[model samples]
Target: MSQWMTLFQKEVLEMWRNFKWIWVPLTFILLGVSEPLTSYYLPQIMKSVGGLPEGAIFEIPKPTAGAVLASGLSQYSTIGALVIVLGTMGIIAGERKSGVAAMILVKPVSYFSFITSKWAGSLLLVWISLFIGYISTWYYTGQLFDWVPIGEFFQSFVLYGLWLTVILTVTVFFSAALLSPGMAGFISLALALIISILSGALSNLLEWSPSQLTSYAGVLLTGGELPSDTMPAILIALLLIVILLWLSVFLFKKKELAA
Candidate 1:
């Protein structure tokens, strides 16, 4: 337990050294704030561009606070996910490549402690960043539009946070299992895309998949009736996270053995 805490502290310091603690949260805050700002000022922006014909009546219906917040979540689904992948793709793979992993493992550290520490550290950073960004978006949404109910907003946050957890776990698994950071990132992104596509194409079949978490979040935000499978989807996502972490530990051990 002490070793894990030490390693986890190391991970945090590394993130700080890399400026992740600065840029990641800032990037999320910007991404979150952009949606409400754009939605509110889009007409003025259009008029400034002067692209429309003379006397053209360009009318965009004002979105509800829930819709605005949901749009912000959609941004996270794409750009936010990409940022997370890029940030974490090298956590284990880079350590191995640079001989850092072997150096650490050669000491009194157990493999489980090593892997779990990294996982916990990375998850903490990602979740904190997401929380900052989402809260900023929610604040702006309330200011520029109607206030989203606190209960519904909280529910959506949890659901989207779960989807992000799944993505981060997949990235960590590949980072531990693969030799190349680029390959790990590529495969992780590809898998996320495929899951999302599958979820959309076969909604009924994959109602329990982690990919459906984002959709369920959107429903919560918009005050729509959640599907009967919401609980199942949450359970499946948690299960997937556990399995991936376990695989990550196993693969990390194997990789070290082969070295």
Candidate 2:
């Protein structure tokens, strides 16, 4: 308990010292602004595009801030995913690279604390950034069109949260198990894409697979019907998160850390 607490504090302090501070929030903010801006202006943008042939009619969805925001949630979520994954790449990689772990290995700090602090810290950074993106999307979306479809909102965010949970666990596990941070991040992304492809290839087990986190979420977030059956999909995603997180911990514990 003491070790975990100490490591947590150290992790927090170190993160603060090294962090650029504004960038995390700014990433979400930029996405937030981009969402509504794109949604509201897309029609005009299309109209402005060069050389629409005479009598060629292009229909643009009338802008509603709420609809724009919901769309933003879907679009900006990709940015959140990038933020989470890349932040994870640096968590363990930095310690191994910077001699930070070498010095700590001499002290009483356990490998568990060292790795666990990183897991916790990286998760904190990802979740907080995701939340900021979510809120900004909502606020700007509301301001742009003022009317939101309540059902779409619920369905979208629930899927978003579940997807985030799965990605966070996958990234953390790979970051711990892989030989380097960049490899970990890229390998994890590849693993995710592979799962998606396999799920499509198999086609029958799509509902139980993690790919639903992306596809099913995209459907609801884009103002489509929310299937009542998605609950089971979310449950499977949650189970995967639990199992992978433990796998990460077990691998870290067994690794031959000098400390």
Candidate 3:
């Protein structure tokens, strides 16, 4: 307990010194504000463009705060992929590059603490940002659209939080397996991109993948119920998080940190 606490403190220090303090907060805040703002303004812009040319066959949902918030939050599909992939890009790999891992090893910090702290810090940052963005978007959405049902929106927000945790776990796991942050970042990017593409191909077959997770959130935001059929996918997400976090520990233990 004490060791983990110490790791947490040390991790916070490292994160601050490395400039993540600015990066994480700014990213989430911007991400948060964008959703509501876009949703609020898009309808007016389209009207100025000429009100759908006097009755196109398609119907646009009345622009509301929830609509905007959902649109903005959907940006997370891209934002999240970029943020997590970059966050863990050089974690262990950087230590290997700079020879800091060896010096840290000589100190009382075990590789376990080192790896654990890195993840703990990153995860903490991710969780905080997500929560902030969630709250802000919720507030703005309500103001812009109408009365967003606070209770139901909160439900979807919490579910999105659960979804994020799983994605982060997979990213960190792959990052831990690598030799450098560059490699880790590439792998993470490849993983995210490939999965996204694959999700389209296997929408019917692989609806449980992270790719589908984003679409599911969009549906839920638009008043779709959590899919009873997706119990398997949701469970897979939980199981994968456990597996990834454990794999990160295992890989770090054998990781030839000197290499």
lDDT of 2: 0.69
> What is candidate 3's TM-score against the reference?
0.84
Candidate 1 yields a Cα-based lDDT of: 0.91
Error of 3 at 33 (Å): 1.6
* Residue 19, candidate 1: C-alpha displacement in angstroms: 0.7
- Candidate number with the higher lDDT (1 or 2): 1
Cα lDDT listed for each candidate: 0.91, 0.69, 0.71
What 10-residue stretch in candidate 2 is worst by lDDT?
A: 250-259
Model 1 TM-score, all chains together: 0.97
lDDT by residue (1-259, candidate 1, tens digit) is 8889999999999999999999999999999999999999998998898878888899988888888999999988999999999999999999999999999999989888998899888899888999999999999999988788888878888888899989999999999999899999999999999999999899988889888989988887887557779999999899999999999999899879987
Worst 10 residues of 3 by lDDT: 51-60
Q: What lDDT is reached at residue 60 by model 1?
A: 83
- Candidate 1, residue 114: how far the Cα is off, in Å: 0.7
Model 1 segments more than 4 A misplaced: none
In order of TM-score, best first, we have: 1, 3, 2
Largest lDDT belongs to which candidate? 1
* Pairs of residues clashing in candidate 1: none
Number of the top candidate by TM-score?
1
